[model samples]
Target chain A: MKYHLILRVVTRLLVGPILLYGLYVQFHGDFGPGGGFQAGVIFAVAFILYGIVFGLRDLRNRFPDRVIHQLFALGVLIYAGTGFVSVFLGANFLDYNVLAEKGYEGQHLGIIAVELGVGIAVFAVMLAIYYAFAARPPRIDDKDW
Target chain B: MELAITLFLFCAIVATAIAITTIRSLFAVVMLSGVISLLSALLFVLMDAVDVAFTEAAVGAGISTVLMLGTIALTSRTQKDIKRNNLIPLAVIILTGLVLIDGTLDMPSFGAPDSPAQTHVGAAYIARTADEIHIPNIVTAVLASYRGYDTLGEVTVVFTAGLGVVLLLGGMGARSRKRRQEEEG
Candidate 1:
């Protein structure tokens, strides 16, 4: 990893754009052809690329396993929380129509919140899985390939 | 031009699948799987399923490949040649493929206006999106609003999978810490 100067430099340049693109997909999902699922994967890819080029230690230090684990649950909580809030407001579970004064406005608000939750959960899960796999010691050496 | 592009992409996908099956090196297999995902993404784009294409490109071509490579790093690069009789499995696959094809024959043609999917709930979702949800993208409206429960369930599924993986592999982290402690001690 240390030897790949080009890779390091290229990854450094690409990570920012990749993350921004993920955000774009997450927010713009309602208008365009993307949502939490694609955005989350894209977000995880940026960090995973950084891990591949820099090192697992650096990545882990930047984003700890604890935070990843918390975010993992936080997303589902956000989704369920939105539904519960709706129920308290005299609407059916996950009924976004009552979220705001205007039905469409409420729908927009609900979708965005739920999508954010989905994005967070998916992103954390992908990264956590990658970390789990990469943290282990390889059974074979690099030269064996 | 569109048909030609679609045909080419399909051919590439088939070639990649064949290569994946025939290749012994796990690394090449992983890369080819990525290639197949990318090609399928292109097909999705061609079919105007951009959201699906994006997901396929991101998850299939990107994350899955990386995960598989990580798995290879932990395991071995070369695949083990298992000397086992494969005739039964091959026959099963062929029979399944034939049955699936036979099932498809009864289905309506691709994009048929009178198709059940086009006429049924799909039409209702499309018609209601503008006035009901006021979202431009019908797919998102359906996924996030109309089918909110389903999306919630999907997120829960992902959460569960992540939890399982962490629980299964949680010991690796502790084991490594112990190894480091021993090395230092």
Candidate 2:
């Protein structure tokens, strides 16, 4: 089925702004109503809209399977690595105070790093789910008997 | 102002729940379920449980709905008629609902500042968080630092779930390959 040009254009315009807004939420989460999880979902929604419009095959082509898998692992590593750094710094896991040893600015930096990790993990997992379902072959029984 | 928004959110939650349960089509049910989750997240916000709401809105409304729809696409959408009655499950649900209502009768009122949850650890966390952690978003500070172990376990659970999916799908493929080889031989 052919998608309407107007609908596609509108989706593109809205998605771009929504994704940017998600990033803003991620960065400004320290003083706002949103955090990593909300930002991640907002980001995922943008790509999901793209998949809905352009079809799953095109989405897969745009973001290959290997890249998504690596991103999934990388996000976890980033989160875990932050915690590991704390351990090396003679502090407990995820100890933000051990980050800069300066002041509140260091804490803000740590929170941003962790939030970004969470956002990336969520975004990759969401896309992975979409790719899995969208790429599945139609059941033989679904065909005309 | 928040109270007005809370009332509207409650109504939205109830409406979404009704819409989800009453829908006949499986796909429609899945989509409506997502809406129900989103509404619940809004309700959580009104309750000042922003962190819980964030997780709910993301995992419940987003990923869970997509997974359910994907499974439905693999299976038949039509609900099969059960020859036997579903009296037992229905009775259990009704009884559970009754128990919940009974329990709530003795519980604290909504947004009671002096409630137990908001008194001890909650108050301590709120008070000392800024001095100890220096993080503006108290939720992240609590989850990642104060309760770091719990967060680690949560991440492990997610990783295990992903591994389980890979194993199950791999097994299915291996079985199919073995069968094909036997047929060829």
The prediction achieving the highest TM-score against the true structure is 1
- Alpha-carbon local distance difference test for all models: 0.90, 0.73
Error of 2 at B90 (Å): 2.7
- For DockQ, the strongest prediction is 1
Quote the B-chain TM-score, candidate 1: 0.90
In angstroms, give how far residue B25 of model 1 lies from its true place: 1.5
Candidate 2 residue-wise lDDT, B28-90, digit = tens: 788888888888888897787887787788778877887786677677565565466678978
lDDT of 1 by residue, B1-185 (tens): 88888889999899889778778998999998998999999999998888888899888988888888878888778889988888999999999999999999999986679988888898999888999998798889999999999999999999999989988877236566787889999
Can you write out model 2's per-residue Cα lDDT over A12-61, one digit (the tens) per residue? 78988988988987777776566766777778778888887877767767
Ten-residue stretch with the least lDDT total in model 1 chain A: A136-145
Q: iRMSD per model?
A: 1.3, 3.4
Compared with the real two-chain complex, what DockQ does model 1 have? 0.79
Deviating ranges (above 4 Å) for candidate 1: B171-176, B179-185
Candidate DockQ values, in order, are 0.79, 0.30
| True lDDT of residue B178, candidate 2 | 75
